[model samples]
Target: MRIYFLSRRKLILLLMFLITIGGLLTINLLTQTIPSLVRTPGTYYMAKTQEKVVALTFDDGPDPVDTPDILNILKEKDVRATFFVLGKAAESNPALLKRLVKEGHEIGNHGFTHDYQQRKLVAEMNQTDQVVFNSTGNHTYFYRPPGGLVSKTQMEATKRNGHVVALWSVDSKDWRNPGVKQIIDNVMKNVFPGAIILMHDGGYQRTQTVKSLEPILNALKASGYRFVTLSELRTLDSDLK
Candidate 1:
């Protein structure tokens, strides 16, 4: 019989290496289970382009109060953004949906009840699409699931609805009601060409988000970045392809 023992220092180093590898594997698995942003290849996180352009997207909107304020801000900035609206919200505020189209902003479906169940999502998406078309005569080409949650089944349903799943490359984390400065920093730090920035308008008290937008927009513009709606970003991607 032969016996061998690793030196204490070498054993510690080997254990550290194994721990690191295990941590990485766990992270990879967790990311795969969740809806992905930039690292997921098949997901539409953002466009791949060199045009110094990005898409600013807001979710859960058409709020009578916050949505109007957000629209005012975007109008003042002369920027067109994409708004993913709830079907219920749109039905209640059909005029707001028309305002989105009138302002040249794009409207996408955010589900009827913000539900992500596969079968429910298909119905929700279809209902929202009809509401949007009836309200604004504009068909929603993008579907961003509530909380960006999507299963393979949900993805297939979205495709069947003739909508592309549009996720985001940069999340402002403003939903937590983080300070205005922190929200600005989160976005400014991650801003990049073809990045789709995620923010919200109607989910809750979104004052901080609205407050953060102006500074973030000014900073990005000063950095020579152009803002586009998500559909426009897709056009850029299609051209590239």
Candidate 2:
């Protein structure tokens, strides 16, 4: 029989090295898996299309202050985007919701309140859907959760409520008040064919987002990209057909 023994100091050093390697591996696995795990199934991040089509989606909106400015900019630029509005906000601003529909913009469900219990998420979604339908006579088939945090169970509930999860490929991070230049830069950096850009029209002062809007549109237009609503962007996807 052959026996090998390490000194106590060497054993401690080896144990520390092993612990460091295990920790790194654990972090790497989590980084790779958590994003995929959090994303709901049947979610549309970007379309699979050859056309230079992009969808600009705003969340937590229909604000009397910022939403009007956003709609005005879209109207002026002759561009149409999707607004995912909360039910409470939609109820308070039916005219804005009506204007969104009347102006040829798309409306989506962003839940009743910003947050809800997991079991009640579907009810919240349905409530928003009802509000949208009542306000605009248009049923909202798309939904985005607050803070983009969704679980499998919540997604299943959303599916039961007949809503497709709408995630984003190009996140502007504009909700953080990241400044107009950074917002534009974030969108420009991730802009691509069939990209869905995330911005916000409600939930805090969206002055920076409002300011960043036109320049982003102009730059993308210069790059030969055409803007489309989320539904239209879905139609561009051959996979969906």
Candidate 3:
């Protein structure tokens, strides 16, 4: 009886060891494939584009004061960007949301309460358009995760909803109020073709964000890059195909 019990314990230990190894290997494989499958093709990086264009995505907003200012800047600069507005925030800023659509910028889902995980974010994104559209009822296709975190469930949900998970290639850390000059410098150094740049229009320390927009737009334009909304960039990609 003692031998039998000892043998059973050994067998259980071996099984646990195998399971741990298996789980690690599975995670490794998934981690390897994430970059390609998630963002860039085959590498999970930014989308490839021949055109000298970039996607500007803003999050955590629809701020009553700041969003309108950002929109005005876009209009004056002859540029449009993607606004990843939160779902709860969206309700309060119905007029601002409508204005985003009216002025020809892309309105992507940033999640209902600004959930950080990609899955919950995607789930929030799925119907944000419907709720917004039913208020006015037009089809819009854009989804960005809050704080740029994504998961398998989020990807699947986004794909099912016919939206791509938009991820950024450049971050100016503008949300940190890292000085307007520093913010400007970061972009000047980091900007790339088909780059998706992240910025926030409404969250705290956004004065720096508002400050950074103009010079970045002007400099990029002078450098021969065209500024376009999130939806327009997607259409450009589809047309390229």
Candidate 4:
């Protein structure tokens, strides 16, 4: 038999490395969990209501391919949703932006480039607002930061710009292309009254996301839940307060 022990210096180094890793893991977990726990003013993760209503929000949209398909499904189901559009995409597809407004869907500013730079938050928002206005002649009151990542200063700037920071409670995780059934289940399992459900219509190959929509819509409707745009959901939330 052989017995060995680590030297004092080696033992200290290993312990420090493990501690650093633990600290990082703790930070990552808190980053994921804190948003659901804390709701700040002028930032909406979900509404506060018990009216069997929820908001459907799509991000990174105005894709020429998938967005139209998603819109058609919504139309067939007679459900209105909110599209958090990128200014670059909206600039490329002005007609789609117009169609969104014409079809009774609400538009939200998702930033100009979908880049997460806290210092440029206000500028990105203004650019997106301009593009949406130029296409639909209407301004967006909701602003969802790219990846739902924002700083305290950025949130204050968003409020000063007269836009509500929109976040989601139930994320479909469809962006991962995790199969249509899984996408449907992700939303169905987590959804609640006044929930803000997140899905992406653009930013990649989103065929699975498009495929998941009809079934998710049908399931929610069957559960006696009504869909509303973020603005309408906000109105319902306000009535409660």
TM-scores of all predicted structures: 0.83, 0.83, 0.76, 0.88
Q: In candidate 2, what are the lDDT values of residues 50-76, reduced to their tens digit?
A: 999999999888899999999999999
- Backbone clashes in each candidate structure, one number apiece? 0, 0, 8, 0
Q: How far is each candidate from the true structure, as Cα RMSD in Å? A: 5.4, 4.5, 7.7, 3.5
Q: 1-241, model 1: which lDDT tens digit per residue?
A: 8998999999999999999999999998765544334434346888888888999999888899899999999999999999999998899999999999999999988999876454588788889999999988888999888777777777777787789888899888887777999999989998888899999989788999989999998999999999999878988984457
Q: Who wins the lDDT comparison?
A: 4
| Model 4 regions more than 4 Å off | 1-6, 16-42, 238-241
The TM-score ranking, best first, is 4, 2, 1, 3
Candidate 1 error regions (>4 Å): 1-39, 238-240
Error of 2 at 120 (Å): 1.3
Q: Give the runs in model 2 whose Cα sits over 4 Å from its true position.
A: 1-41, 116-119
Q: Of the pair 1 and 4, which is ahead by lDDT?
A: 4
- CA lDDT, every prediction? 0.86, 0.87, 0.74, 0.89
Predicted structure with the largest TM-score when compared to the true one? 4
lDDT per residue (tens digit) for residues 1-241 in model 3: 3544458889899999999999999999765543223343311225467888988878888899889888999989878888887777777788988888888888877777766544455456756776677644665566766666566666676778787667777777786676999988888798888777878887565888888899999999998898777666666674345
Error of 1 at 65 (Å): 0.8
